[model samples]
Target: MKVVAIGGGTGLSNLLRGLKKEVGNRIEDLSAIVTVADSGGSTGRLRKAYHIPAPGDIRNCLVALSESEEIIQRLFQYRFKGGELDGHSFGNLFLVSLMDITGSFISAINVASQILRTKGEIIPATTEDIHLWAEFSNGEVVEGEENITEYGKTSKAKIVRVWIEPPDAKPPIDAIAKVQSADLIIFGPGSLYTSIVPNMLIEDIKEAVEFSNAVKVFVVNAMTQPGETDSYTAYDHIEAFLRTTNLSKIDITILNTKMPSDVVLRRYIEQGQEPVIPDVAKIARKGITVYAEDLIGESQDFIRHDPDRLTEVILRAVSHALS
Candidate 1:
């Protein structure tokens, strides 16, 4: 299968990490369409300094799919402490440096891919300089992804909608073609607004999805993101995802039915997050296939989708259809 996974943030990268193992077995080609509208942290600073698309998410995805030595991967992910470069990950700097050396962002990614020996291609959603802007239901418009999330969380205002600055940024040609040719396309398992939905804001990419034959799937996040989808049920996520992209429907929606220990839940709850209620029936009623499972995995008190289990489920779902 030629698979195309869309979105950005840790979720997409984590998924790619798992899916990488399936190459040549269930997946013949794998591609990630990453959101580059980030405007916060190291990525944001770099964007301001170098005028390049956000590279943090792309860095994470590339490392996840990397087939390089463990030491090399560690080096790429390394962060300098208590220095002028504090908080900037090594991978981000490496990409930026390559961009300077090559004089092109896309070229930098290609070179980095070769160095990392990434299993799959990591393509930015758009090469154009872009920033995400979100409008809150309270009639407030927040620019910059970090700012939007902060405003939404701190002000307790729901984000009514979001869009890119250019509003018409063109996606890389391969990105459009990948969506058009994909047998499987997955969205999210990440922040609904900042991570997944931003990719949908690109018109060309959204239109490509509409016309594709791919079995579109939206993997519901294991927990509610405080700033985005604060109390969203599984179906509410589906609603927001479709509404943002103008995609009529999703073919399948994956949900994590298991919850972590109360101690862990308490920590998230105190931080204003909660287990995303698996309201599977509502989504199922929409004629979309709902696949529920114990997809949650806890490590170091952090809740994440178990990559192995998630990948097995996804491939099994695809294999069944092909059979």
Candidate 2:
């Protein structure tokens, strides 16, 4: 199977971890299309200082697919403490250095992949240094990925639309080719606005996905994002995808049917987030297949998709689609 997963952040990385395990020898090719519009923390700082696409998300995805030793992975993920480099990750810095030396972001990623012995490839949605901008329903316009999320949380208005700064930014040909040749294309398990949707903001990517013959699956976030999808349900997430991109319908929609315990739920509720209700009937009414399962898992008081369970659900969906 040729699998192509799209999105960024921890969600995509988490999914990749299980995907690498599940696909094992079955995958003919695997690729990840990551969003580079991030302008937060280490990624943001690097983007501003070096005029490069954010490497944070790419670094995470690379580690997720890495076939290297556990200690090597830990080293790549290690963050500096108590210095000018305090919050920066070693992997991000290493990637930046490679970009400088290789004189191409794509080349740097390839070198890093070789070093990590990654099971698959990782490609940025676009090679350009792009910033994400959003227009709130309140008629307020915000620039920067981090700023948009922060403003959304406090603004009285919902996010109306989001777009990349260049507006004409095109995804790399490699990214488009991967999507075009994919057997299965997965969309999120990530933030609706910042992580996943940003990739679709690129015109080329959106068009490529729309025209692809792959079995498209959208993995709905297990929990509502405080600033992005505050009160959104499963159907609302799909609605956002349709409204934002040229893609008309998702073939299969994966929903987490189980909820976390109250203790874990309370922590998220305190942060103004809640479990995303799986409105199966409403979703299926759109002529889409709804695959609901107990995909939630709690770790360190954080609720996330149980990677193994998620992998199983995805494989089953693809198998059914093929049959």
Candidate 3:
């Protein structure tokens, strides 16, 4: 099977970890399309100083699919406790230095993938240092990914639209061809606006997805994001996605049907969050096939996708589609 996953952050990495095991050698091709609109944490700091593509999310995905030794993986994920590099991860710095030495961000990623012995290829949505600008429903325009959370508080301020500046940004050639030849294309279980939608804003990216023969699948979030997608239902999630891109429909929608344990739910509610109670029947009416499974996992403060279970759900959906 050939699969291409779009979006970035932990969502993509988690999915890759699960998929890598199942498909192993049967997987003829696998690719990840990562978002580069990040301007937060170590990635933002690195981008500002070096003018290189943000490597935080890319590094995470690379490590997830890596066949490197356990020690090497641990080394990449290591965080400095104090001093000048406090809170900075070693993988981020390694990528920065690699980009500097190679003189190209793509070249740096290629080298890292080899070092990690990654199972699949990874590509940025675009090589350009593009900025994400989102318009709230109240007519307020928030300029950065980190800033969107603050404005996402109001129900009246739903994301009206999002677009990358210098709108003609082109995708890396490998990225376009992957989508064109993919057997399946999966969107996020990540932040809707910040991670997933930003990828669609790239002109060539939208064009590739819209025109491709690949079967598009969407993995809906289990919980409503505190600021960006609070109180959003499953239907609301799909609608928000279609509103952002040129793609007209999704082939399969993967959702979590079981609610989390009450203890976990309470922890999230304390932080102003709740599960996205999807109306599966309503989603079916929208002309998209709905696949529900127990996808939630236990986490300290936040609910996360149980990567193995979620991967099973995705594979089942694809098998059903192919059959």
Please report the candidate that would top lDDT against the real structure. 2
- Which digits, one per residue and each the tens of the lDDT, describe model 1 over residues 1-323? 99999999989988998999999888999999999998888899899998889999999999999999999999988988987899899999999999999988889999999999999999999988898988898899989989998998998999888889899799999999889989999998888999999998999999999989889888999999877899899999999999887998888888999979888888988999999999988898999888899997877588899888898888777666666
User: Which stretches of candidate 1 lie above 4 Å from their native place?
Assistant: none
Q: RMSDs, each prediction?
A: 1.0, 1.0, 1.6
Model 2 lDDT tens row, 1-323: 99999999999999999899855576778899999999999989999999999999999999999999999899889999987999999999999999999999999999999999999999999999999999998899999989999998887478989889898987889999999999999999998999999999899899889999999999999999977898999999999988987578789999998978888889889999989999999999999999999998767577999888898899898899899
In candidate 1, which residue pairs clash? none
Clashing pairs in 3: none
| Candidate 1 accuracy as TM-score | 0.98
Per-candidate TM-score against the hidden true structure: 0.98, 0.98, 0.96
- Relative to the true structure, candidate 3 reaches a TM of 0.96
Against the reference, the lDDT scores of all candidates come to: 0.91, 0.92, 0.86
Off by over 4 Å in 3: 154-156, 298-301
How far residue 236's Cα lies from its native spot in candidate 3, in Å, is: 0.6
